[model samples]
Target: MVAIDANEVSKRYGTLQAVDRVDLTVEEGETFGFLGPNGAGKSTFINMLLDFVKPSHGSVSLFGNDCQGEGVAARSRIGVLPEGYSTFDRLTGRQHVEYAIRSKAADDDPIDVLDRVGIREAADRKASGYSKGMAQRLVLGMALVGEPDLLLLDEPTTGLDPNGAAEIREILREENERGATVFFSSHILEQVEAVCDRVAILQDGELVALDTIEGLRETMGGGTKLVITLDRLEDGTLETIWAVEGVDTAVATEESTVEITCTNDAKMDVIVALHEAGLDVLNFRTEEASLEDMFVEYTGAGR
Candidate 1:
């Protein structure tokens, strides 16, 4: 089931086309990552989903209801942690959280929410005195006020330290385990890889790839970095590697090591081909391709 569906959404600013005709669907109870470079229209797409920016052309639905229909009843069912969010500096952390709970008509206690986000000890402190990471945590805690069914986070961990980031990730996991659908947008590919079940990558306001990590790798001409310890470099080795199907590039040095880049399901073939090339393979390690590599390959190559 799709928790959020965007059909052929397009947004334009003057002569600049921010979001092209893009289609996206986020499954219920899934942690979906929205990834893109700057100016790739991620923010525009998110704003449209929240009804903050009306799409130039297209439709948005949340839990099978039109996003723009009625008085944002659909929005009340979801939590949002926007990028560069700021709160009233004079309000104490506890007051901010209490206000958010009351505004959302939530039944949960604000103390529990503060503790869950690890900000309880400092709840009575003024927001003006909180550090960047602490302020971000308060914002996230505000979003958790009602335990909404869906969470829309934009760069949720932007100003956090490693420990804080880990804490936030753990909280997200716990929420997902409790059956909440999480739509998290971020440029940090490593964080996305760690937390998201599926990812959609956008480039220059265009959707380039959408799939599981493994699936994306397969579609981008799968790359494998081979660290081989050879007894000695042998002749015909380079020629033999190029002969392997899907082996797009190979560099072998006189130092008895070869690094290879290839496509889908080509590692085993590469190993066999290398052995066939008559080099005594002492140890071989293949580095799996990451989302960054796929991004570079597709966007950099102008695909």
Candidate 2:
């Protein structure tokens, strides 16, 4: 069964079209990543999925239930960590978790949930006195209370330290393993790259690219970039490097270093050719194009 589905989904406010006509599907048991820069309508689309904001046109379904008509049923199976989520200032951290448990009719222990988020010690403190990161953790723990079939996390790691972010990633992995479908939405590429099965990039409120990471690299004509540091550059080195099979572009970045963008099969050949030319190969490294690079290319952000 598809975990989440949207057809021709669009949202408009006055003269502004927040989300353009877009179709999306996320399969069950997969960790799908939704990526876009700020104001790209990611949050708007998420709101539509949760029925918090009605779409101007199109339909959405959660776990095969009409999200709008069957709002209660659709939402009952989902846990959400919304962007800029605010907790009651008077409630202690433990109270927040307990409230979620009561709402879901779940038998979860508040202490256990707090421990999972690494905020157990802060459980007795009121939210009004909590740090931003601590408040984020408390809300995240609330999301975990019912162990819902789907998790909708919007910038889940915001305000978190590196260590805290890592902890959240680990928790996501555990939840996915327990048969929950995760929809992770973030503008940060590195965070999603580590855990997502497939990614969709939204540009200007339109779906620009949707593919596996490897497929995206191919679409962008982005292959591995090999940088070779050598003792010296030979007279015919550039020409020979270009002639190598699978080599796309070769240029000298420094007096003694050459950068070559080529397929994996051609990387070793370039090194051998340089060695045969009597140049001492000091060191070499390979760099892969990241999702951020592809996002920039597709959105024309780099232009």
Ten contiguous residues with the weakest lDDT in model 2: 294-303
**Stretches of candidate 2 exceeding 4 Å from the true structure:** 225-286
lDDT of 2 by residue, 41-117 (tens): 99999998889999999999999998999999899999999987899999999999999999999999999999999
Candidate 2, RMSD to the unseen true structure: 5.2
> Which tens-of-lDDT digit does each residue in 1-303 have in candidate 1?
788998998999999999988998999999999988888999988888888888888888888777877427668789899876898899998999999988898887878888998889988999999988889899999988888899999999988988889899999999999899999998778888888899998888888888988888767576665566777777777677778887656666447887666764777787787777776788888788766666555565311
Best by lDDT: 2
Give Cα-based local distance difference scores for all models: 0.83, 0.89
